[model samples]
Target: MDFTDHVVVGVDGSSTSIAAAVWARDIARAGHWPLGIVYTQGMAPDVREMLGEGGTLMCVESTLAPALVQASRTAAMVVMASRGQGSTVLPIVDAAAEAVLQEAAGPVVVLPYTTWNTLDRPLVLGLDAERPSPASIRFAVSVAGRTGARLKVIVDDKGQGPDRARLQTVQVLTRVLGSDLPETFDVEVSAHELTDALLAKASEASLTVVGSQHARRSTERERSENRLLLRLSTSPVAVVANTVEAGQADGSATR
Candidate 1:
């Protein structure tokens, strides 16, 4: 259960699952972390061959959601396909992925089947100007540092001036990241809705990170927006659990 230095991915033999495995492999390779594969249904032999040697394989008896939830406890990050083999619909995340997003204890990356090649692209962080999550910020910074990608922080604010937006973002970043902030980073404040802003930027990003208050029940609107981004974003979407307390900096601005 201790996967602190591993990039864990859930595989179900679907094309999307295979793609998620590949993405996890690349991330593990970049960070010099081991790759852990968890299979609840079953894993394809081809997937094993594709991954090659030295990856840990886990076969769980429970469902995908429970297995992933347990793995997320100490895993560096848990990766899953937006939709599995049971789903044929477009623009909708599968049940297991949605459940994991709502309950996973750590960061979860949901990769859609249409995920674009993200090499050398910027890492997009969708920040809530009002209530930024420290956990989200640290994860984004760590990933950007490992991949040598520019960290682009997108803040969704209506009626706020660009200068004010930048100031607020900087204050939050400084408070959370301190001297660990990436050397190359920029802030973008948009008046558009959070989903719209992230969608526009995701087209050119390697990965888009959003904070969610997974410890508590999320509003229906919040769930809808997260699903929309997971379904339509051009890149893999990381749903990091916001550890901030409720009512005070709950990190809902990006939700």
Candidate 2:
């Protein structure tokens, strides 16, 4: 089926996958977008059993690789559960979720199964302290603008260049969004570790925003930071890739 501009969710019958599907459903409903539930070909029977009913089955060779590629090609945004039910930690970005953040061409939202009131907290955007990506900021701004939600921009200066990083971040947002940046949006520069700082802020946030990694080309530190943020955040984390323009958003083909 054609899934253009739709919200696509990857499901393996795990609790996390179900949570992702539910979250995607709410988002699609809120945005008046279509929703597609995707299931890989060789997942376990229990995973299949969770289907219970009919939905578009995006049969693929691998769960994260092929499925995400297809989702990126046809979907506007892909939703994934950070970790499944078997995870030892309460929340962690599984290997599949990591691959999605690294490779997805569009926006990806990684969520945990934990419960929280999305309406009460503000939307938090975690800026890259080294080189902030304009796409990431713009995407977050778009969401906050649409939802009329308060936005918090978090920059972990730590030992990195806080002044330079903060300047670049504000410039990009102001350049890309101009006066469109929400009046409720605020920027915060911190000296704490990137992951640690974001976790603390996200604990009370409704949703956290982050940029995508450069897939195979990303450094170990880049990949680890994104993974840690996804795994540890108490709020839903949105990972926006630099593939499509922030305005012309949505996902997958293959590589």
Candidate 3:
């Protein structure tokens, strides 16, 4: 199958997984990109019924990481439900889903089964003041643009004072967005823990964007925080690669 720009979603028979598939369908339709529904083991009959027509459907009996890696080889972005089939009550991040986000070469969007509706909220971007990633910023902005939502950028203090953190975030935003920074874009520096601050602000967000902390050289603490955020987020989370791929694709890179 031609996988260029395809929206690939992983399904595991959960309602949240179906929601992810539906969201991916909308994204694929909007962008004129093909959609691919991937499942290993089994799929819900209702999910098959809900995913009526168009796009490619692949079923494999392999494990999660291998399946996700194979999907990543072809997919521009991988979408997965935050929780798995066995999850009940709250949807916490599972090992299989974490593996996908950790190793996926491209972007991975995690859809959570939140009780609270988040369809009309703003988009939140998590910026690492010590080392801001342009790709994450660009991706967040692009998504906010598409969703017609305001963009709120949050800077992780990581031990810096509020004033210093704000300056660092402003510098990174200026460097990445230039004069094109939308009037709806807002940036703030937070004194709370990265995950805590993001989650606290997530109530006002339909989606949150953060840099992928899965690289080999990333500190254990950073990786752990990212994973924790993935697990506990009430809003959808888009984990973008740290490279400037999004800026390059949109011809907005200052580099």
Candidate 4:
């Protein structure tokens, strides 16, 4: 796919998910970029019965999938909130994030919620961990253009794991933004303090962009818990995975 103009989002069977879908679609349309959504139900027969008739949940594929595709360069994905967010401050990413963070081959944007922090403040794409893919940069650029929000490239502790990664990440970011990304992009090198740093910046920003770790989820419980913590935070979140949500076209389910 032409990732240079694609945007993806993760959705669960939650009520708030709809808002995220709508918001993502709106932004995608505004930017004229391809938008995609993903929803995953895993191998749980009970979940399949709970979400659908067969052993797999079809609500997402049949319901909200289409809308996502039509929205510029966008797609939708739905996974079991396998890990959902955790209850702690540094919770893990649920099933949805695991799939996106690990499998999404592009700069993925992990959004916790779709509709929030619509304030007219500056928008910052937090690159605390993993290098962004083409998708991530496209999402950030599209978001900034659509919202008219000043975009900042944020470097949190996650991006500074080792000296090599830190330097390489900064170099990548610099290449991504070129003259657009000013030298003032906030650099937070503290460990667990990333949450605080992000939250503090969120207070002054219209929104913050991040990636999901669930895509790399190895354990169900751990991933679920982290997603919960992220969901509970003050900032809105976006989760990206390798899958897409085709059911969104019918506009029947949430994102």
Off by over 4 Å in 4: 1-13, 34-93, 107-115, 127-142, 154-176, 179-192, 211-232, 238-255
- Model 3: per-residue Cα lDDT over 1-255, one tens digit each: 445557788887777787888877765654455788887665645556777777577776765555765676556567888776776655377666767765676677888766363546777998886677777787777666655667888877778687888787887788887875666678777888778899898778877888854342334212766777877777778787675376322322221
Q: What does the lDDT come to for candidate 1?
A: 0.76
- lDDT ranking, best first: 1, 3, 2, 4
Model 2 CA lDDT for position 242 = 51
Per-candidate Cα lDDT values, in order, are: 0.76, 0.67, 0.70, 0.44
Model 2 per-residue lDDT tens digits across residues 46-163? 4445543433456555555457755766576788888753555643666677676666767778887674646357878888745666667777776666555688888876665778
TM per prediction: 0.88, 0.76, 0.79, 0.48
Better of 1 and 3 by lDDT: 1
Which predicted model would earn the best TM-score? 1
So what's the TM-score on candidate 1?
Answer: 0.88
Over 106-197, each residue of candidate 1 has an lDDT whose tens digit, in order, gives: 78888877877565788899998786667778788777776667889999765788888889889899888777666669898898887899
Q: Taking the tens digit of each residue's C-alpha lDDT, what string does model 4 give over 55-128?
A: 21233433333323332232322222213323232333444444444444333334453335553666766564
Per model, how many backbone clashes are there?
Answer: 0, 7, 0, 77
